[model samples]
Target: MDDTDTHLLRLLQHNADTSHAELGRQVGLSATGVHKRLRRLREDGVIKRTAIVLDRAKLGLDLMCFLKVNFKNNLASPNLDELHGAVSALPEVLECYTLTGTNDAIVKVAVRDHVALREFLQRFSEAQSIIERVETCIVLEEIREGNDYAVPKPQ
Candidate 1:
């Protein structure tokens, strides 16, 4: 990834719908050149699938909560994969991360209301063999939320 490649990535990160010709104009490359670079980036796995960002509230997912989960055993335990599979299968789970220190994992979930939240918790409780305890925090408001990332210059 060179400077031009990084610049293209940054532009695409901001708006995936930007035309190749426009990107080329900004990055000083031809449309075909821009297309080739983007193709290479996708093939190299540097660029993941492009997706549209949806409004959660408008989609009826009004409640957003973060769940801090503590596992019953070590992270290296055999049941780790089982827990991961289960979590990944949940559509409500927007993000799940393994963590160090006190919490074993943190899960970001979106639901319709308190009833849906409770239902999610009930389903989560089925994995109690690996999960020791869970702490929940409801997001009252979202000041800013985005998945955009800054593309760093190549070393």
Candidate 2:
């Protein structure tokens, strides 16, 4: 991607709701040009679906935790895909990452509170057929939108 594409991505990442005129001004393109590029970006999958950032706490997800999961076997093993698929299907399981460490996979999960977390943990733990073990860290704060101005500052 060239500078314009990079700039577009940074801008969209901050606020997908930005008007084409506003996006054009920041990137030094005409609105029509910006619109075309944005379309192409979406068609080519350079840009995924635009989304809004929701307030997690307000949505009843008062807790944010990262779960480091250790599987009983390696992903390359023939039977491991079924096990991983099961883990991924759990709605509470958010982002899942295959890792290179003592842990086999990492996931992000959010819940209402400690009690709910404990309940979910117990259920997952008891499912000895798929999960091996998990470690979780409660997030206190996060910087999700700091790259806001990394693109051309909205003009």
Candidate 3:
């Protein structure tokens, strides 16, 4: 991507609702040119689907917790696809990733309150027999949460 493309991505990252005309005005391109570029970016997979970020707290999801999970079986021996599929099906689990360390995987969960979180954990534990232990850390405050990434200038 060139400088103009990088600029366009940065602008879209800040506000996906930005108009093509406005983007053209800022990037010194015509509306048609901006649209073409954006289309190309999307086709190239540089630009993924645009989505609205929500305030979890306002939506009654007051609890955010990170769970470190260790499996009873060895990592190489277990069927990871089954584990991932089970975790992904849980509504409360926002993110789950396999990690390299003491824990086999890490999960980020959002729930209504402590009671809800407890119930969610109980359900999660029951979902998979491979889960040996789960360590949770409740997020007291979220100072910053964003999906934006830095777009480097073309070399």
Indicate which candidate wins on TM-score: 1
TM-score of 1: 0.94
lDDT of each: 0.89, 0.75, 0.90
> In the order shown, what is each candidate's alpha-carbon RMSD?
1.2, 4.1, 1.4
Compared with the true structure, what per-residue lDDT tens digits does model 2 show for residues 19-72? 999999999999998999989988998776766777778989888888887766
lDDT of 3 by residue, 1-155 (tens): 89999999999999999999999999999999999999999999998898998989799999999999888874755547657767878999988888898999889999999999999998888887888899999998898888899899999
Candidate 2: 10-residue stretch with minimal lDDT: 145-154
Best by the lDDT measure: 3
**Local error of candidate 3 at residue 53 (angstroms):** 0.7
The TM-score of candidate 3 is: 0.93
- After superposing candidate 3 on the true structure, give the runs of residues whose Cα lies further than 4 Å from its correct spot: none
Error of 3 at 92 (Å): 1.0
Model 2: residues with Cα > 4 Å off, grouped in runs? 78-80, 126-128, 143-155
Per-residue lDDT tens digits for candidate 1, residues 1-155, read 99999999889888999999999999999999999999999999998899998989899999999999888785866657867886877889999988898898889999999999999999887855688889999999998798877667999
